[model samples]
Target: MVTSVAPRVESLSSSGIQSIPKEYVRTQEELTSITNIFEEEKKAEGPQVPTIDLKDIDSEDKLVREKSREELKEAAVEWGVMHLVNHGIDDDLLERVKKAGEAFFNLPLEEKEKYANDQESGKIAGYGSKLANNASGQLEWEDYFFHLIFPEDKRDMSIWPKSPSDYIKATSEYAKLLRGLATKILSILSLGLGLDEGRLEKEVGGMEELLLQMKINYYPKCPQPELALGVEAHTDVSALTFILHNMVPGLQLFYQGKWVTAKCVPNSIIMHVGDTIEILSNGKYKSILHRGLVNKEKVRISWAVFCEPPKEKIILKPLPEVVSEAEPAIFPPRTFAQHIQHKLFRKTQDALVSK
Candidate 1:
């Protein structure tokens, strides 16, 4: 759907342009509303996004494990996002993932473009900057590398990066670990929702049919950071998203009427509830709106893996366990492919988003 062939944001930022092109400049009204809300909440000792320790989530002690699940449920219902610590992912492996991405982005422009994504042809895998598909035709100040990592056999290696000798190796290992972690979290959430531990997973398509896709976002330093957004505000379409970043904070969430900046916790992954989960929970849980902000002095990079159901097979809606005569299902059933189509072509407003 992206038709623009504009230069990559990384190239534009490095070119030392005195001001961003008009297309990238957001309207003054838009900037003021976002800027003013963030400033108003800046001085308050606002609530921080909940940080959950996963070390005891599976403890042999029954009481301890129950407490951990309760904490996880509370965070999910209240914030729709949380910081995960002691999540069993190796520190060294996390560093390797980060280095792999940095190496690829550091490649020569001509070399990097070799794997450019052909969005024009309906292919989303590979590297490229998605330009101006919005009403204003404004470009986001970010470039990204996206590819499928799970359903391992479905991986199209041709579009994957080959220059970073260990890119595939590191990312593959990371994806494997994240799959297990996400499954564990989903089980806990299901139990908290009063359903069988495996109910949610089954509804989303069991491991054999689950889909995991990774997007490595690169936000370059902008000369006029306030005039442009690193990424627009939108909720993910998947069930869950696990994010790893390089210790630079730029992620923001719309919470309790204010934009809250998520502070990064070293070695901790940020987890987000996506639209599928909200619909499946029948409004018991939420998928919040989030956006990224650009920095004037530093580049910010993040790796986000979206865990979802097989695109066409799973019909997402409220699970029978969550919906009762007293609590009706607010969302209608729809396959993931249909959901994506509506969002992509602007067929209609997505029902999954409450606002």
Candidate 2:
């Protein structure tokens, strides 16, 4: 995708999307001095979320669908993340989605406030700076698009901006496409786990009330990026996650007692197995924790689509077909939302992010 305003660091390294520095989070201690000053200015100023206005965003690539089922399964089991080459989303849709975000975020605070996420609606909307509080309870480095993705009820077309009508369509289309890809992955996982081909689809249908969500994160140009963060170290609340990232070096994954770069590939989607999935599998599958690091050099854009359970559904044990009585439940039965809120306020990386 061609853009006049993407980060400048895209050319800094050989890896287009796969080159975030390792241990990027822990390296910032002293530089944060300026942040305290900036924080004061932030307190005195009126709310002004940063945004880059664009007429549209577009790209032409199909590279996430070519993975073999075996490879998909292994990615879920081992890394808890993968690079998807083709799963059927167009460049224009992706660009427009990003453009819509740029425009929506650029809208006046009053305009952005009109459709704020209604607790009753279950659609977490509007804008939030530092939305995800980390284990330390400090504000997250970047803001995000936290809203419902499914359950026909949450699709309030009226609340979203129709003037940017094409934006809504693009997001809806993106959601559906991600759902299909998630289903495909789930199916492969079932087979990988030695279950009958249709086992998960049939039994897991109980989770239809579960809806997905999207985190459209745009990290603004930071003067002290290392001192700040785009996101914190936390596992997802859903069963699965598919992340599409452009060239930005902010994404990090927790692995083998250390943080590792996510090796983001252009036109590839990174798959993250979530806490619920790990629980359902009796800890067989992994749910890796990850953090996003903003840069002093440039702004970053990341699109993460979470594949979740139905709202009322409890993401507990997978199924009797997938496991035995000896295995037991990986997690205590609870609603996915409950699990997320419990983790949000809780401290410590190990506390809220596991089975």
Candidate 3:
């Protein structure tokens, strides 16, 4: 019902402006060339890595232990994506979130539209999908309930979905779970780098600068799966993300020059490295590019929680040890704020990829 027959480019405001050339916009066909570099799926259109149920895996056993933490780092540095089986978040909580997401999105547009983004009217933002043109491919069948996670209390919580009050409770619980996992993994990263937890905290900031958005993506059964993708190929901007997905599969990652399917295990979280680690690790680790593909037979759901640096933290220079006089900085230091703004509004794949 929210479908727009044709997408139009929405102009930006005069403030906080930068002009990107118009020709940079790539169509669905053009996206294939970049994707082909890493994907093995031979469909004329996209990858079809199968999704697996997490209940089948024993996440209680870690592939690498605390003593061999370097192995953990090596794995992340090499793979950038991992499957977490024993994460232990309650199943009731997941179901609650799903129900709340469905309840809110199913509301009449008149009610939902009250919170819609109003660039023309200057109201800024609220719940719902990005403008159709924000994505190069035909849009995903997902609907989301988004809110700011930084500066914690500074957000206008009143504008959030009032009907799904329990959504706040469920999502906040998930945020805490994700934060705990991020810290646990950070400790491993510290060990791998031969640094201590305290040092790792200081290198970034003692602050946890992350955006905890509960994206409730719904994939209605599609008749034509190849004509469009659930999400286009792209990289996540956070240092890492903890994802909880519905049993229905479609998540795929570009890896080792082949597209590998990320099998979804119920109750397990998917850990993915983002762009920041590639810089912090001195390119020892590269963030993986991923996309969502829909199915003709099922509906899908995913909640991706992004763990990042604080907006005020300037990741401009590498930790002195990581970059020596002989080595150059991987990329100029930029604030989490700038990274966030670009993620929210930049209109093209080239905008993120070229830089």
TM-score of each: 0.93, 0.72, 0.72
What is the Cα-based TM-score of model 3?
Answer: 0.72
Return the lDDT, model 3, position 197: 63
lDDT of 3 by residue, 199-286 (tens): 5545554445444544556555544454445666788877777777667777778776766666555666777777776667666666
- State the lDDT of candidate 2 residue by residue for 1-355, as single tens digits: 4322212222222234333433223333323422332233224233211111111211222233223555566667777766666556676776777777667656655565566554333445644444223443345445555666665566656665654657678778778777766676677677777887555554444236446777778676554454555676678767788776656666666666655555435556677888877876767878888877665555677878777776555445656655667766656666666777667556556434542
Q: List the RMSD of every prediction in angstroms.
A: 3.2, 12.3, 8.2
By the TM-score metric, which is better: model 2 or model 3?
Answer: 3
The segments of candidate 2 whose C-alpha lies over 4 angstroms from its true place after superposition are 1-67, 108-110, 118-123, 131-136, 202-207, 322-330, 345-355
Report every candidate's CA lDDT.
0.85, 0.59, 0.59
Off by over 4 Å in 1: 1-3, 33-44, 345-355
